[model samples]
Target chain A: MELQAIGVQHPAVRQVQHIQNNTAPNRYKLFVAEGLWAHNMLLEANAPIDTFFWCPEAIYADEAHRRAEEIAARAERSFRVSLRTMEKMSERDKPDGLLSLAALPRWEPSDLRFGRTSLVLVADGVEIPGNLGTLIRSLDACGADCLVLTNRKTRLTHPKVIRASQGTILTVPTVEFEETGEAIAWLDRLRFTVLLADTDEAVNYRQADYSGRTALVVGSERYGIGKEWYGHGYQRVAVPMLGSGDSLNVSVSASVLLYEAKARKANW
Target chain B: MELQAIGVQHPAVRQVQHIQNNTAPNRYKLFVAEGLWAHNMLLEANAPIDTFFWCPEAIYADEAHRRAEEIAARAERSFRVSLRTMEKMSERDKPDGLLSLAALPRWEPSDLRFGRTSLVLVADGVEIPGNLGTLIRSLDACGADCLVLTNRKTRLTHPKVIRASQGTILTVPTVEFEETGEAIAWLDRLRFTVLLADTDEAVNYRQADYSGRTALVVGSERYGIGKEWYGHGYQRVAVPMLGSGDSLNVSVSASVLLYEAKARKANW
Candidate 1:
């Protein structure tokens, strides 16, 4: 594998810096995934690779080099940058020696498939990228049908979100809706029972029947589910907080509900 | 109420800076809790608060000022600092304008009281302050008897841990053991069923019986339960991950198990 030498002033290098700083516009549709695990995830998901950056000194493992070689082979462009250049491209204090730029996958509502026993997670207005990413991992672990991102504050492909999800964000199917009502209406048309996680007249989450097609609506930590989602015949269920906190972290709450549904359906 | 004026050069101000930077030694026996919610939790828990700092301009809400006044009345030392100095003392981007220096609570093995159906979360080798803080909140939410900290990489009173735990670190009883063996032996002497979260020959987490006195042992993400934990009469349980990622975040995993046990024990 021939490694193309690059400098910090190169357009591709600048692009990586932009992506790391989150200054790059969405028009680029490019994401910077850092570290070996991310490289493997991009490979496993067959993400469209635009470029691969490597630091030979940092990648000591033979298996890692082989995987990087494979990635380079699959990419349209690849380069070997100096450790200092790699440092500038990395968001973490310690760069993991491998980084890749992949085109974000586009998904439409039709791309999702829901079954009679499907569990879909509808995230409404989640501001924290880390929380959204954690939710993706939790949803994926429980085998949720797909995540419908409605009223999202951060892009599904944000670097922090991608990293926090541990690359599960790449595999999980996601569709975005600008309005919560539109998302709810789509779920209603699909004959899915929507359970809004709210404190009003809420029942223990375990009591809510999750055996069949279900959609759990999790809201932001501050504002909660949009008022648009209220009074739509959606059942309100709460994760009982036995202590002083009014709510659990949004990600933790979603995971608990997802696992409960999975357990009831015997998905594990 | 008269404001005790202070400036950047004040000795107390220097101490706040040291605590925020995490440069203060354990010998100081002081931790800073920032923001309004943390202040309230400190008040409710009756934590030994040594000092309180307030910015009147930031305390706009009537209820907030009342709470600040209440805190000031109870504190041994209280001062009003300029907004600029308050910003310097805060770790948050937008300082909430309230900071408290509290004496770290000391606990021992004898402080823990377990019921027949008690659920205890044993955090072994949890290296991240954020993860430890989240675990404290999760365990508190599930009404776990206490969190036994063993093989901890970060201090339980780390500002980030306290901030992440939303000051629950003060309310939740925590006893630390320098070694994992000491923690395990204590659990054994109490006849607690130690369920270690490991992927090796593990049963489904949901399939495990968590109805009785149970202690779920959570390990670090990189190096799971130390080798010393093996060969113990402990059951290995796994939270199934159907995604490309290997495991859930440590805090998320422990919360799931803690809630499961709480749900089973009907302790909610």
Candidate 2:
């Protein structure tokens, strides 16, 4: 294995930068994981890495350097780049000297599998990459089996999504739907009880039954859950807003409901 | 009342810019609220506005214009400025033609009042402005009585804090402590049960007693609760983390705990 030195104008560097900017059409086909935490999680999951780029001068931590070395050894292709080139390819003001472009795990409706008493989370029209990522983290914390994104607004491969999720975005089983109707139909076929977080004609979230196969649905701050999700047999539940705030942050609402569902299901 | 025309070089403009940059020594004495949502909130709360600045050319919405007029009529002082000058005074890239410099509500430990079965939140060492703001929004949502910030890193008057809080930061009675020991002693004296969100020797949060006068304490993501807070008869409780991530976002954790305490207190 040889360390090929690349400059700021290198095609590979340009490609990563375009992917980071999300200018590339195939951005969803691949994603970049920067910093030691995301890279360690990638290695821990043994996810396939298309390429690894490192700059010894940019990394400040010994642990990051070690992880970069480990990644260089294991990556299918590895490149050594100058600090300037690394900065061009990095998202943060300070580059950690390690970056990996890896294949994003793609799942379809058919790929989603469920068991008895399965827990699933459906995030609809969540625009903020950080919020989407935080929702995924909450879903993971509740030991939810899968995340199904419908009416998706932000790319799942967004760097903020990966970082805010604490790298669980790499490990969590996630699927996306192009249309809300498709997701509703699939969940209905699977007999998963769809619970929509709504403010009107809704039961207290605590009083709602989360037992059996459950799919907790939350919407973005701008738009409540889509109109398509309504008029269906889905149960509507509301977290009590006792003060001046119109509602809780979307991620906060989702986490509270997810934990409640998990507790009720486990009889904790 | 005639509106005084101002320029970018005006002392008031420079003072606001300094406060926005958090460079002013008395930054905590006044805070800026930008855009329509925060302005509407301030008006709804009847919060005192020391000064209001509006740009006719920059405002695009009719509702915003109406709100600006309403603010100008009620504000102690109002100014008309050029769009470029408004941009200089505004935080966002595109200013909504409204900004207010208002006196930050100052509360002290002695000012904190509680009722039987009161709910309070103590954020210890939370450094992120947005996280602190979101915690305040959650506190408001949970109908918590007051917010006590100890080991505070970011100013409560930070622009991001005011914005992220959805203006609840203005209404939520908040008090700050210079020392963690002072907060501890005050809570103890008040007979408020202090529950620390900790991972060690902690019971499941769902099983914890949130019935009496409860103060839910959360710490920064970097540092857990201060060591001084422990071994002082404070209860330790943990939200179950059933994922690869080490912990949830500080705001998410705080919101979950706050809602749980609220629900338990209301017997919902």
Candidate 3:
């Protein structure tokens, strides 16, 4: 194994720490993915890795060590760091000793490919990284063709999102647009019907049709869909909330809606 | 407004800090609820309050101060703590200048009252406080009759769970059983059909019958339902996952299932 211990002051460690910021990840074109699960996901997705670091003693099981070695073999640069050093570079309180810095994969609006009965998810101004990540996992689980983040605040490679998504971010085809208008135009040009999860003047989600090409749009929890989305030929559907907690968590809302679409698609 | 300023080293502040642990909240029969939203929820539910704390500067609007004063009038004792003290006592980084120590309501399994067509949630060994909180919110939104926590690890009044639940924890009818066997026996005796959210040998959730008295149970993400639950004649149902991430977040899973039950109940 070509493993050499690196110091806390290593440039690679510094880079990983700096990339935790909102803009630095995009600026550096690098992001951090930690833990054995995320590492395995990166390996499964065959994501490009710039630097891979692991602590020898931290990996307990022999099989896990073998897998870590296999992952290290695929990386451009590999190093062994002290447990303390690993802790400094890790985002989690309990570090699993596996950390990777990989080049961010770029996906644009034009890159989104839709099938005859495609299902897409549009995150219109989602702010929280954990919520955004959970939505990505749900979107991927629902087999959505693509996820488009409009009026984006959090970077696609945010560590909290990466952890919360459990590496689905690496596997799912996700893209971002600066403005919701761009996303709207793309949907319009693709002949995809838009369904907004709005509470007012909306039909029950079960009654809404998701038989053909459809894009399910969910907005921030605090604010409903933007006013600009109203005039368009979009149908608003509400997930029936029966009690005082008037609004569901954004991630939960997305899951129910996507699964409802899946149910309709299957004729259930 | 009978609001007196309290010091950081006050007994009440220390007491609040002590109750942050798992056992202390229940031992003392007290739990902390922070922010205006939770405060309002407690008032709406007419929950018993021990003490209410707020900062003068934290109350931004005159109307908000008036409401705080009205809530304080109902409390046994009311005090205004400095912003610094409030920050220390508050669980959230952005404190809304409202914190309350309230008497935790005791709800036993016997207290669970169900209708003829009751919908119930059984969180079997759900460990994460946030996930549990989100489940409470979703369960409340779907108008489930009650939430029965089986083999629960976290206290019902954990600050993180309360915040994540968006004060729904204050309103939802919830009870806990130390053992899964007890929960199963309770459901069986009540003639409530048990629907376990198990991925193995499970039918699609849509196909499961939630027509009459039903108790939908979800397990921990790491370890699913225990083996003891197998021979109880519980129906196993799976939420169809279409992509690489084989499992949905526990909270999201519960929301979709409860909403499905709600949809069926309404015939939508």
Candidate 4:
């Protein structure tokens, strides 16, 4: 079993131990399971898991071990490992003994097609791993159809992301585009109204038409949107910042925009 | 200068010697000025700065450095550290050469009086320093009057909170509460309506009237606000989360709630 190869004694494991540098997950269309919370969240999301690992510490006594065994019995593939090794693999210092390599969630943006108009989030060149995770979580909570990442510098398959995303990346239609300008052009071709959140914009976010097939485009925290979208025909809206700060976290901005869209769509 | 004792030797002086850790800044109320961008934001926000540590590798070589010099000149106290020491103090290994130590801003909540009604963010028992920082940043961006942390498990003085706020903690009004229940009672006595964002609440956040003196209360990411408010007649409202993910980042939830309040206040 592939599970046996991951044990500490196995020599092949060391070569590919770094999940960030490993392409096997994407190549084989597999997603690494994180800690127990992510495992449980995936199960709750009904996303498929291919293999499961149980670290020794995950169970306290014989009774708990029996429960762990019972749960493992439900999985098609499962294994047991020492706490030390599992802790090394985990992002968190202390992890519940369970981890799983879930099957890559098959995602399709076309599935987001709604009969009525809706607001969607389009992230342009978001390089930060944590921000990507937070943005996906926000998109899912606000009922956005899909989040399209255009030319991300950070690898989507990075293990840090899967851990940070609370496994919501599985449920969200996580798609990517080669270039943001091209993505915007495709949206324009589809006649989807686009809005850019620029600090220099005149119109307040609340004044926009978020009830339709509106797409809110946000850029990286570092460079923001480049020459691609500037002075384009898209409406530029800014959240009314009444105080002294320049901007909010890129992910928090996404959440605020998506929530605003939800509110406007529902006509609050 | 006290800065010399630390022997600032790093490239981007601030990056090599970042005050990102709670230990450094919390101990002395002295934080390392991170980057030109951050320092610029600080200037725009009118945050107090005690000294400036300039490095040659930094833009001081470029004409842009001339403008930066103007800002540096404004520092109440300033120093010139060798690029070597700047590198030592810098966290960014490359070392842009400039590191500044600024006294943490001292600000307090103004008299809790709203002439024409208002919207505010009230955080309760939030333990994550990053979450608190994000909350403060969102409040600053959304134009929320202030963030009140009552019954907080994490110190508002933690450096992660400062870093997470992108330095807005200095610009925003942050008040600590001995007890969330007591704070709510005080608000009630002062005619401030308390809207607690609870998971079990039936009322949608949008449905609530935020045009009044509103305080949007959020519990920690762990267990939310303690049930003490349940005894009080506080209005409980939650943002409508329409997805399978049961939890959102407490800060993300705060952003959504704050913006809703912003929208209502604008209309009001």
Candidate 1 clash pair list = none
What is the per-residue lDDT of model 1 for residues B122-238, given as tens digits with 9 covering 90 to 100?
888888888888899888888888898877788876877886786677767888888878888898898889999997899998889886799999998789777878898789999
| Candidate 1 residue runs with Cα over 4 Å from true position | A55-65, B1-4, B27-29, B56-66
Q: Residue-wise lDDT of candidate 4 within B1-268, one digit each (tens)?
A: 1232334443334432445544343544566666666676667767666677765545554544664576577777555666666656666767664556666655444554555566778888888888898899888887776778777788665557767888777777766677666677667776788888986855888788776688888987878887776767778888877776777889998888888777777772
Query: What's the C-alpha lDDT at position A164 in model 3?
Result: 79
Q: After superposition, how far is residue B11 of candidate 1 from its true place, in Å?
A: 3.1
Per-prediction interface RMSD? Answer: 1.6, 0.7, 1.0, 1.7
What is the overall TM-score of model 4 with all chains considered together? Answer: 0.84
**lDDT score for residue B123 of model 3:** 87
Fnat for each model: 0.54, 0.85, 0.85, 0.76
Provide C-alpha RMSD values for all models, in order.
2.4, 1.5, 2.0, 4.3
For model 4 chain B, the run of ten residues with the poorest summed lDDT: B1-10
| Candidate 2 chain B minimal-lDDT segment of 10 residues | B20-29
Report the first chain's TM-score for all candidates.
0.93, 0.96, 0.93, 0.83
Quick one: best TM-score, which candidate? 2
The candidate scoring highest on lDDT is 2
TM-score of each: 0.93, 0.97, 0.95, 0.84
lDDT of 1 at B150: 77
Clashing pairs in 2: none
Residue A131, candidate 2: Cα error in Å is 0.9
Please identify model 3 stretches exceeding 4 Å from their true place: A23-29, B2-4, B23-25, B94-96
Model 4 root mean square deviation, Cα atoms:
4.3
Residue B238 of model 1, lDDT score:
92
- Per residue, candidate 1 scores C-alpha lDDT tens digits across A1-268 of 5698998999989988887677868564688888777888888989889989988877767878889888888888999999999998988888877888887787789887788798889899999888899898888787888898887888766887887788787778888998777888899989888999997799889888886789999998789988888888889988888776667788888899888888888755
